[model samples]
Target chain A: MASGDREESKCCFKEWMTTQEEDLSELFQALTVEPENIDQLKQLAEKSITHFQDYIKRRNKLAHKDISAYFAPNWCSPWENSLLWVAGCRPSLFFRLVYALSGSEVESNLTEFLLGTKEGYLGEVMSSTQLLMINALQSKTISEEERLTMKLAALQEDIADQPIAMIAKGLSKVGEMNGEVEKVLDNHGRQMVKVLEEADGLRMNTLKELVKILSPLQAVDFLVASKKLHLCVHNWGRQRDQKLGRKEIDEEC
Target chain B: MASGDREESKCCFKEWMTTQEEDLSELFQALTVEPENIDQLKQLAEKSITHFQDYIKRRNKLAHKDISAYFAPNWCSPWENSLLWVAGCRPSLFFRLVYALSGSEVESNLTEFLLGTKEGYLGEVMSSTQLLMINALQSKTISEEERLTMKLAALQEDIADQPIAMIAKGLSKVGEMNGEVEKVLDNHGRQMVKVLEEADGLRMNTLKELVKILSPLQAVDFLVASKKLHLCVHNWGRQRDQKLGRKEIDEEC
Candidate 1:
C-alpha cells in the first residue's frame, strides 16, 4: 500500500477504537442498571448475547479474508507474518466487546468458531452477552465512504424543501446531464438554491431538468459535488453514540 | 493485495488469537487461585494490566511507524486509516481475560470510567491485581518475526537429531553453488553433522582461527544452525502455560 493508504488505515483504526470504547462503556452502564424486572431482563440480555456471539464469529472470518487478499501474488511466507502479527497484537475491538459482555459464555464460543482459513488458534469469545454487544455495534458499522454517501443523501433531502424553479436556478444547462428537477432550499427554507435571480427563467428551467434526470440521492451527491461526507458522518456518529449510551439494556440491537 | 497474501494474513491472525487465548488463559487461571483474596490480589494484577495497556499503546505506535516508514517517499495522511483499521481491533482474548479476572475483585475493580477518545472512552479497572496481569503479559509479548524465527529454529534443532550423512555429503555437491548446507544428522549422532563431530577436535583451533570473525550470539547461532529454536520457544510456551494454568495465580511474565 502507498503512504496515503497506510495513513488512511491508521485513521481507520483510531476511529474504530473510539467507537468501541463508547460501546463498551455503554454496555457496562447497562449491566449496572438494577432493572425493575431482573428475571425477565436476564433472559433478554442472555438472548442478545447469544446473537452477538454469532456476529463475532462472522466477523472473525474478516481477518482471514483481509490477509489472504494481501498474499495472493507471490505466495511467499514472509508476508504472512505481518498479517499474523497484526492479528496477535490487535484483534477487532468489536470482537472484544462482545466477548466481554458474554463473560462466561466464551468457553462455548470456541467450538463454534468457523473460518475458511482453518487457522490453529483463534476461535472466539464464548459467552452470549459479549455476542449481543458485538451484534449491536456492528449493525451501525459502515466504511468511511459508505457512511459519507449515506449522509450526503440525507443532507440533500434536508435541502430539498424548496420550490422546483428556485432549486433549478444553479443549473446553466443541467437537463441534458441527468434530466432532473430541483428543489433546493436556503437555511431559512427560502428559494436561494433552485432559481438564480440573475439568470432568469433559463437557469430555473435548466436546474429543474437536471434534478429530474438524476435519482433523489444522485441529485444530492451532484449538488454537493465538491464536498465530502466526513463532517456529516461525524455529526451523526456523535448523536448516535449518545443515544446508544442511553439505550435500555434489554432492547434488541 | 492478492488472494495469497490475504490467506497468509488470515492464518497469522488465527495463530495469533490462539496464542493469545493460551496466554491469557494462563493469567486468568493464576489470578483465580486466591479467589477470595479479591481486592489485594486485584491490586497486584492491576500492575500487569497497566503494563499490557502500555504495550498496546506502544504496539500501535510502532505498527504505525512501520507504515510511516513504508510511506516515506510519498505522503498523504500516511495511510493512517488502514493502519488504524488494523490497530483499532483488540487482541479480544487479552481484554476478555482482563475483564474476567476483574470478577474476583468485583467491588474493588468496579470504578468510574474516564473519557479519553473524543467520542469513545477509556477507564481504569481500579484494582492493582488487574494491572499486574496486564503488566505480566506485556513483559513477554514478542513481535511476529521473532516468534517465527524462534519456531523455525526449534524445528531445525529437532530435525538435526536425525542422522543421514549420505544426504549431507550429497547436499554438498548437488546445486551446492548456493552454499546451502543440508546436514542430515543420524538419529544418534554422525557423519551428516561431520562438522559437529569434528567441532570438539577443531574447537580450539577454530576459535583461535576465527576469534575476531564473530559475535558470541552469532557464533552460537551458527553452531546451532541446524537446530530449530522455534520448537524450543513453543515448548517453553507450552510448559510455562501449563505451570501458570495449574498454579492459578502467577503474576510474573
Candidate 2:
C-alpha cells in the first residue's frame, strides 16, 4: 500500500480488459463462421461467461480492501465515473440491452418478419416464454437496485452522522482527531464494501440468469453486444472528456 | 463513462508503470557503468524527469473530470489507498527517501568513509549545500501539505453540510429528488477536482525542485532509488493484501 501496490492492481485490471477485448474478437469470429457449428458456439458462450465470472471474482477480492476505489475508480474516465451504479453498470442494463436489440431487429424487418415471412430471425432470437421471464427479471433487478440504493443512502447519511460529525466536533475542540475518527471511518468503509459486494453479486446473478434464458447462439450475440457497448461507451466517454477539456487531447497522439 | 472507458484509463496508467520499470533498469545500468559518464547520466536523469512530468500531465487532465478517482484510485491496493495523500505519495516523501539513502550509506561506511578513509563514498552523493536545500524544501512541502489537508478537511465537511444534507431532506420530500440534488453534488465534485489539481501540481513542483538541487549523478541515483522503492512497495503491498485475504492468491498463479 505504501508504494506501488496499487499500480500492480491497476496492471492486473488492464490485462483483464485486454483479455476481454481479445475474447470479444473471438466471439465475433465464432458468430461469422459460415458452417454454424452449434457445439463450438455453445462452448464459446460458456467460456465467455466463465471469463466474466473470473473477472468478478478478482474484483470482489479487491473490493474487500478498498471498495470506495471501485465506487470511484480512477482508471475510468470522469464521464464514466458519473454513470457508475454501485461501482459498475446496473444489472438492469442487461435487460435494457436485450430489449433494445430485440426491438431494433423487429422494427427494421417489421412488415416482412411479423407477417411470418422471416422465419429464422424472429423466433430463433427469443421465445414468448423467454420474453416473459426477462420481464420478470427486469422487475426483480429494479427492485433489488432500489433496495441497494436505499442502503447506499443510509451509508451516505452515516458519513454525515458519524465521521464527518466527529471530525467537525474534533476541529472545534482544538486537536484530538485521531483514533475515534479513524474507527468511525473504518466502520463506514466496511459497510460500504458490503454494499458494493451485494451490488456486484446482484449484477453477476442477473447476467447468469439472462444467459441461461438465452439460446446458445443468442447468448453469443448478446455477449458480443454487451462487450461492444462497454468498449464503445469507454471510447465515447474519453472523447467527451477530451471535448470538455477534462482530458488532454495530445495524450492520444 | 457508461461502459469500459475506465478500463482504457487503467490500461494507460499500467503502461506508464511498465515504462517506469524499464526506465528504472536503464538507470541502474547507468549507475553501474565504470568511470561514470556524467553527461550521459545527466541526460538520463533529465529524460526520466520528463517522463514523470508527462505522466503528471496525463493524470492532471483526468483529474479535471473526476478528482475523487485519483484520491481513491481503484488501480492501487486498498492498503496503498489508505496511505495516499491527495491522490498520491506526499511531496515530502522525496526528502525522506533522500535522507534514508544518505543515512544508510553513512551508517554502513562510517569508520572508513568518514575518517577521510574513503574518497568517493559520501561527499560525491550529497553535498552540504544540497542537504540544506533539501531540508528547506522538506519544511516548505510540509506547510503546503498542511494547507492542502485543511482544504480537504473543509471539503469533507461540505459533504455533510451540502450534498448529504440535501439528499436527506429530499428523501423525506416524497418524490422531489431531482435537479437540485444533482446540482449540489456536481458543484461538490468540481471543488474536489480543484483540490486534486492543486495537490498534483504541488507534487510535480516539489519533485522538479528537488532534481534541480541535485548533481546529475545524484539525481540519477535518487531516481533509481525512487523507482525501486515504488516497485518494491507495490510488490510488498500485493503480498500483504493476499495474506489478508483482501486479494485473491490464485490470481497470481
Candidate 3:
C-alpha cells in the first residue's frame, strides 16, 4: 500500500512496454493454420492483449488512489511481454502471407523502448519525427487487398482458435447487449469494449470467409444475431413442417 | 428482450418449485453403496453438487431477471441435467450412506421426496416442513462417529484427488494478502480491529490444519494474512527461509 511500492510496480509496466516496441521483432511471426498449432500463438496474442488490459486497469486504479488494490499476490503483471508476443509475431505472419513483409525499425525500436529490453532503461529507439516518417512510409507501401487478407487470415487462423478469445467475445457480446451491464461489472471496463469490438469484427470477417461452409440453419443464426433478424431466430426451433418452403421472399423480409 | 418472456422464464423457477412432493419409488427402494467403491460415491456427489451450484446460480440470475444470462448452444450442461441426477441417483447414494453409517432413514419414500424423485421442483422440496422435520430428526440422531468417519472420509478422499481444489487453495493462499487490501478499500466500512479478531480465529483454524504439511514459512505466510498481522503488506517476497522460529515474544520485544 506504500506509494513507493506503487511507483516501483508502475516501473515494471513502463519498462515492459518499452521492450515490446523495440522488439516488434517480428509481428505476425507466430500465426499458423493447423488447428493444434494455432492455439499456442493465439494464446500468446490473448496474453499480450490481457497484459495491456491489466496495465490499464492498474493505471486507472493507481490514478484513482486505490493503490491498496493488491493484484495477484501484488504482482503487477508486465504489459509489454503480452504485446510483444502478438506485435511482431502476428503482424509478421500476415506480411508473410500477403504483402512483402515490412518490419520497420521504428516499430521494433519503439516497441523495445516502451518494453525496455535487457538494459534496465534502454536508449530511445525512435524520435517523434522518426515515428511519423515510418508511419508515412508504411501507409504508402500498404494496399487494401493486403490489409484485408492479413486481417482475415489472423482472425480465422489465430484469434478464433483460442478459449480466452471466446471469453473475450462473450464479454463483447454482453456489451453489444448493453453498456450498463459492462459498467455494473466494473471489474472489467474498457477492456470489455476492446475485446468485444475485436470479436465482433472477427466474427463478421470469419463468417464472411466461410460463408460457403455455413448451413442454412447456421446462416440463419448468424443473420439473426448480426442483424437482430428476429424472424430467422424464431424459425430455428420451428423450421420443421415448413415443407411449403422454397419460395423466395424480399431480401429485407 | 421481451419483459414478458423474462418474467415467465423466472416464474418457471418459482412455479416449478411449488409442485407436489413425490414419495420414493421402486428405483431407490433397493439402492446400496459398496464401502470400498468410494469413486462412484465421489463422482455422484460432485455431479450433484456441480448441478446444484448451477441451479442456484441460474435461479439467482433469473430472480435478478436475467433468465437468458447463461444461455449457450450447450444442451448437455450440468444446469440441464443436475436435478435429474441428484433426484434420481445421488439422493439414493446420500440415503444409503446416511442409513448404513448412522441408522437413519434407509426408506426410499423420504429420500425420493427430498430428492424430487416424484417431481423436480425446488419450492416443493424446500417448503415441505414435514419432510424437513423428519430429516432434521434423522440428522440429529446420526452419531458424530458416523457422520465424521463416513461422510468426512468420503470428502477427504475426493478432496485429496481434486487438482482444481489444490490450485484453488494455492490461488486463495496467494490472494489472501489482497484481502487486507480489500478491507482497506472501504475506510468507513473497515472495522480493522473487528476484522483482525475474526481473521485471528480463521488463521488459527487454517494454521492448525496446515501444520502437518506446510513448511514453517508457508505456515507463517498463511497465519500472517489470516490474522492481518501485516502493517503495510507492501511486499512479501524471497521466501528463502522456511522457518519463522517464533516463540511467544514479550510485548516489549
The prediction achieving the highest TM-score against the true structure is: 2
lDDT of 3 at A24: 25
Candidate 2 — which residues are off by over 4 angstroms?
Answer: A1-253, B111-124, B162-164, B173-177, B247-253
DockQ for each model: 0.01, 0.02, 0.02
What are the per-residue Cα lDDT tens digits for candidate 1 across A1-253?
2223323333443444344334333333343353234454344334433433443343333322232111111111221122221121111222232222233223334444543332111123123543353454434332322343233223323321222222222233222112233111113112211111211222223333433433332222222210111112223223322322321111111
TM for candidate 3 is 0.17
lDDT of 3 by residue, A27-139 (tens): 12332122235444345434444444455555544433321122211121111111111111122211121111112223445676788842101112223543354344334
TM-score-better candidate, 2 vs 3: 2
lDDT of 2: 0.63
Instruction: Name the Cα RMSD for model 2.
Output: 18.8
Best candidate per lDDT, number?
Answer: 2
Q: After superposing candidate 1 on the true structure, give the runs of residues whose Cα lies further than 4 Å from its correct spot.
A: A1-253, B1-26, B60-65, B68-86, B90-253
How much is A252 displaced in model 3, in angstroms?
19
lDDT of 1 at A216: 33
lDDT of 1 by residue, B1-253 (tens): 2323323333443344344434443333343354344444344334333443444343333322122111110110111112221222112222222233233224322432132221101122234643564454433332322243233323223321212211221232221212122122112123212222222223223222221232222222122210111122223223322322322121222
| Predictions in order: lDDT | 0.27, 0.63, 0.27
Worst 10 residues of 1 chain B by lDDT: B71-80
DockQ: which is higher, 1 or 3?
3
Give lDDT tens digits, candidate 2, residues B1-253.
6223444445556777787888987877787763268888888878888887888788777665555456655566654454456666777667766765566556545755657564222234677888899899989987897688657645643432423332432242222335664566567778877877788789888988998898877777678766765554455445455544453311210
